[model samples]
Target: MAASPSRRDRTLSAHHRKKQPEQVRRALLDCAAQIAAEQGASAITIQAVAERAGVTKGGLLHHFDSKQALLAAVFEDLLDKMDQEIDRTLADDPASRGRFTRAYVRACFSDRLLGDRSLWGALSVAIVSEPALRALWSAWLDGRMARHAETDGDQRLVAVRLAADGVWLADMMEKDGGLKRYPQDFEVVLLAMAEGGN
Candidate 1:
């Protein structure tokens, strides 16, 4: 048999072996999101994500034991980021409910500035594939709607929330040839809704 591996070789190997579970998970989720954005949510898979992230199958498994776990992580990441941005936007004017709504609309439709659309697409897939995720999203939406209602009152807030959802869904589906066709018009409507108007 050959001599034992050198100390340097062992050190280097150990360094490379470090799992960095959180980093790996983030990388895998980002990769999945990118693929989803490019080819739709149906294209996301463990093998594909591993390849995109430049990690081996075993390495990916070290971070997320299964595809379902990975998908859940993706959804959690997106929702957390969205919540952070919403908080930041609302922090500027906590007293003005209209400002909060405006910020929320801007956060959602402001292009890829928020987060990769692939992540959102992955979330869309997760919602359908996993019932728990669907429940989580529904609960989150209900909370958001309740908060909006506190500010704008019941009826108007409901309309605004529905309209905002419509806008978000339309944008996600790339319907009407994407937002370019009516970005300005949509923005106006969003602002109006935020302001509790038509």
Candidate 2:
């Protein structure tokens, strides 16, 4: 005869028997990101995230010690995705000069962060308003800038990067048509500058 599982075992199984620890952690981060994207960062309570992620509060705690920690982790995850997008963009370009800067411009214009209604757009409010998140973002920017110092260090390239950032910021804050309101050739001009053109 087969033996039946006990209450504790059933509870454990219900929580995450099929998912590995990493999977659970990933799920938690993804759930948090979705909540932040849809409802803004202020809505990301631990209880809300845990319930939405199909885990108990204690289970979520096992992965993230506190709400602030979870928010930081979610922000880091978003930055990681941005890094991947930049890397993919870099891979397609053959030019060495201004390569990293060009990738940065491309990423800024990418759908992931282009407008107020985007996932990154939803999260940008937190990135700028939350002190902890802003610190993390600053550190990340500093590191990338340092790494690309050799290739993207030209003054003109730096100016182009700044322009791209301005456009992205404007788009994020725009309540109307977003990036479409900008000149159609805006990105092209940035890319041309990235390529060291007139």
Candidate 3:
């Protein structure tokens, strides 16, 4: 039997109604990121994000209890995004290679990691300004580095890892400001270094 027109409309409407809150929450997060990028942390108030997101202040509060909560959510979301990219890049490694280190290097150089400077800038600010957040970030990176470290070649692992960081930093500086890029051949040199010449 065919559904009545009003019943069909009601089913679609109900589905959209269920999605409304999630849509609003996403909008609020996007507004928060934009504010952090464009105006820095001081500008990312609940009222500001709500207005930017076309929602009431109460609507924002429903998703985030406070400004700190909101910023933490934004920071964590960016980190999750970064981790996913690193894992995805890591998955393609071959068996007979410096798998972990190469994956780490490739992950650093990925567009996923290079994405959205405003989000990166905001998270960087948070990490630098908050001691707890700084400690947490340090622990996470230290764990990754430890896992990638070669048991018999700690110095080589550190060297290649640092080279990857150097490459990532240079790339960010060039895009974030007007910092001059390294010579065009530098990335090739950096990746070769990551290969550990094995």
Give the range of the ten consecutive residues with the poorest summed lDDT in model 3: 176-185
- Cα error, residue 79 of model 3, in Å, equals 1.1
Candidate 3: segments with Cα more than 4 A from true spot? 1-21, 95-97, 111-118, 146-153, 166-185, 196-198
lDDT of 3 by residue, 120-157 (tens): 65455566677756676777787766665553145665
Which lDDT tens digits does candidate 2 get at residues 1-198?
A: 988999798797786657588999999999998887777778899999999998889989999999989999998998999999999988998888888988888787777332434667777777888899999989999999899888888789889988987876776687345556665368888888789422
- Inter-residue clash pairs, candidate 1: none
Which candidate model has the greater lDDT, 1 or 2?
A: 2
TM-score for all models, in order of appearance = 0.74, 0.85, 0.67
Candidate 3, residue 121: how far the Cα is off, in Å: 3.3
Residue ranges of candidate 2 with Cα displaced over 4 Å: 1-12, 15-19, 112-117, 183-185
Better of 1 and 2 by TM-score: 2
lDDT of 3 at 18: 51
lDDT of each: 0.68, 0.82, 0.66
Q: Pick the candidate with the highest lDDT.
A: 2
lDDT accuracy of residue 30 in candidate 2: 91
| Candidate 1 local lDDT, 118-157, one digit each (tens) | 3564355557668868877888767775676556555655
Q: What shift in Å separates residue 5 of candidate 2 from its native position after superposition?
A: 13
